[model samples]
Target: MSLTRLLPILGWARRYDRDDLRPDLAAGLTIGAMLVPQGMAYALLAGLPPEVGLYASIVPVLVYALFGTSRQLAVGPVAIVSLLTASALSPLFEQGSAGYISAAALLALMVGAVHLVLGFGRLGFVVNFLSHSVLVGFTAAAAIIIGFSQVKHLFGITTERKDHFYETVEEVVRQIDGTNGTTLVLGVASIALLVLMKKFVPRVPGALVLVIASILAVELFDLTDRGVKTVGEIPSSLPAFGLPDFDTGTMGSLIGTAFVITLVGFMESIAVAKVYARRHRYDVDANQELIGLGASNVASGLFGGYPVTGGFSRTAVNDTAGARTPLASIVTAILILLTVLFLTPLFSSLPNAALGAIIIVAVINLIDIGEMRHIAHVKRSDLIGLSVAFVATLVLGIELGILVAVVASMLVVFARMSKPHSAVLGQIPGTTSYRNVERFPEASVTDGVRVVRIDAALSFVNAQHVKKLLLGEADAISGGDVTALVVDCSGINDIDATGVEALSEILVELDERQVDIHLCDVKGPVRDVLRRSGLWDRLDGRIHATAAMAVDAVTHPGTLPESLRSLGIDERHDERPADTVDTEVSHA
Candidate 1:
């Protein structure tokens, strides 16, 4: 592999246009403004000090810009990953405590290591096992959890953390009477301002506006004296480079969480990357994306921050603000670095409620009711997977919930594959085309011949099932009159050893009933498998190019179809040798 391929910046940096600087700078500054508030808010959500979010925005953003494929993807502390970090570390140590902070950094390192391993191994396709339905469900549930988790800050009332969503709801309800009126007003006003700005002035960074306004309001009105909580005394220094503590016991405890974060975070990053890549008509190598994200997370861990990923909202903003290259992200990192250096003290009076409000608004759209309805209408089985994921995540906590959803999705896939769609086909009127007889009632079927098609790869899991279905289709025809079974191999793109064995058994059973078996439309790969297994020689002179040719031969013996005549077949049985026949059939 070339060095440029591994280090993507090497390829793009050399091609950097002078004209791209303006847009890249504009987009970078816009996202930087947005990330200032979002990064800190997400950090607080992850049970860390707000500045850690700013720290994450700096190093991780710079790293991903250098290594990532997407030009517009803005990598930082995202809402879902933050919630996941909190879910993982909250159980082991108190929120914001040094132990919890150290563990969070360790989790980022572990997640980065996993991504690098998967990327280098070219195993990025493993994320596809997480079906879209499962993601929708899991995301929606996690959004709810994240939104509700911020309620204490919104209301300025402390509540004990609970394991389940309902328990959290119960605690919030019991403490409803203790709500701080001043904080509630500020949070509500911040949410309103954000919503209005998003609706009317979308180009403006509403989160930044809210942060500035809230801080100014608190500083001027002395809101802390009114029992309003504030993000007091942010450190005015850049993040120092340091490795997370390497405790084996802590690593063991965090391994599961780290793995989950790696999968979930990479999935989120790649999904958005692919979207923007398609929009701009470029390719995104999935394995390379893993490398980029892995490196970013590693940087985040080494620089006093938590795990980060490409966020949809921030990426959308980046693209809209005219980000033409990863240079925009680098600009974003520079802005965050400047803020950590000089502007940290200015945010000392920023109310916690405003940050909570920003978080709630950010996650509001994640609970997608419309997507649920769409899933229900498109595929009820997928809806079941979605519902299972949503409920499980809400009930069983984030880790177990996603685990159950993945298992359920895999089971659904296996069940469908085991009983794949098989149909008895008949010829359409005045045409050579064959279709399912059940769907095309007007189609004509030849007597003493059954044409069956199985629409799945024939493997050990479904080999027996295909055999049983083909046999059942033959038996469905009146009496023992079936003399020929034409198996359509067009849909059967692949067949394993077990499938060949199953076919052999079927051939023996049919021969006993005095029925001849014919294979039609055999794909090249399946034919090769048959040849290697010696099944091709066993079934010599029985394979044809099309279903119609096979039907004609069975119904009118000692006569060859005009199409077959060109292929050098005899008028009697097709006596062509196996090797030669495949060559002719492939061309036909």
Candidate 2:
């Protein structure tokens, strides 16, 4: 591997010109404008000091820019990761305590270590275990939970945080009488302003506007005396490098949360990276992304920060503003650094209500109702998976929600493969293509040939199922009149030992029924496996390039079964004319 492959900055810096700087500067500034309010809001979401969010944004963005492949991906404190941090640490330590901070830092370090190892081992494909449906369900539910979790802050009421979403909602309602009128007004007004701005002037940073307005209102109207809570006492200094607590007991408790964070964060980052990479006609290396994210988290841990990941909104903002290289992220980091050094005090009077409103607005978008509708229309089976994940996350808790969703996804995959789709294929008139007989009723099958298409890879889990399905189809056709059974292996991309055994048994049974088994459109790898397993010799060179060719050859009278041959049926002459056959098939 070249140095540039490991450190992407070396590759981009070699081609960096004055022309690239203009867009990078514009993207960087735009991302920075959005980052300030979001960073603070997400930090509070994680139950940490507001400065921790800014601290996380700095090194993570700089580190990922140096190592990540996606030029437009902006690494920072995202709402999901922050909510996960809060969920994991809330039970172990009180929010805003030194112990909670240490635990959060340790979790980041552990997650970073896992990402680094997976990246180095090139195990980025492990994320395939997390199905897209599960992700959608989990994200939608988590977004709702995060939004409701902020109700206390929005209402300026004190309530003990609960694990389940309903418990939180109940607590908020129970404390409704304690709601501060001024804080509620500020939060509601901020959310309304953000919604309007997003609809009317999308180019403007509405969160920044809300923050500025809230701070000015609090300072000018003495809103603090009227029960409107301000952020209060933000430290104006850069994050000092520090080591996380290395206590084994704490480490043991955090390992599970850390693993969850590693998987979820890497999945979120790489997904957004691949989207923009594909749109721009470039490929994203998943392993390299794992490394970049790992390095970022490691830096975050060493600098008294919690876990962080690439935020989709900020990345979209970076891309929309014309980011040409990782230089945009570097610029974002520099601006955030400037904020930590000199502008922290300006946020001192920033209202917590405004921060809550910003989080609610930003996270609500993650609940994709349109995606749910699409899934429902396309596949009802997926609706079960989505509902399980969404309800599990909302009712059980974040960690258990992910666990249940993963298990459910795996089970769904296994079930689908075990009962894989095998279709009785028939040729369309004057076309080489074959389709399912049940779907295209006008398509005709050869008189003495049965073409069965097993539309899944032949694996151990579905080996017997495929055999049974083919046998059932053959039985459904005339019992002993079909002399040639062509198994269309076009969809069978691979075969295992169990699949080979299943095929061998299928051949023996077909021979007993006085039928010759032919394999058509066999994939190269599957053929290689069959050859090695001695099934190729059993096939006796009956394989053909396509299903239609196999059927064409077997349609001859000489190839017909003894019973069909004795019936004196002319195989070459269709007893039914082409038009008549089409009409009969279509009506049937």
What's each prediction's TM-score? 0.94, 0.91
> Candidate 2's residue-wise lDDT over 333-450, tens digit each?
9999999999998999999999999999999889999989999898878877788899999999999999899899889989999988888899998898889999999998877678
**RMSD over all Cα atoms, model 1:** 3.4
Error of 2 at 545 (Å): 3.3
Error of 1 at 358 (Å): 0.5
Span of ten consecutive residues with least summed lDDT in model 1: 579-588
**Span of 10 residues, lowest total lDDT, candidate 2:** 579-588
As a TM-score, model 2 comes out at 0.91
lDDT (C-alpha, whole model) for all candidates: 0.89, 0.86
Cα error, residue 223 of model 2, in Å, equals 1.3
* Candidate 1 off by > 4 Å: 479-482, 559-588
lDDT of 2 at 46: 98
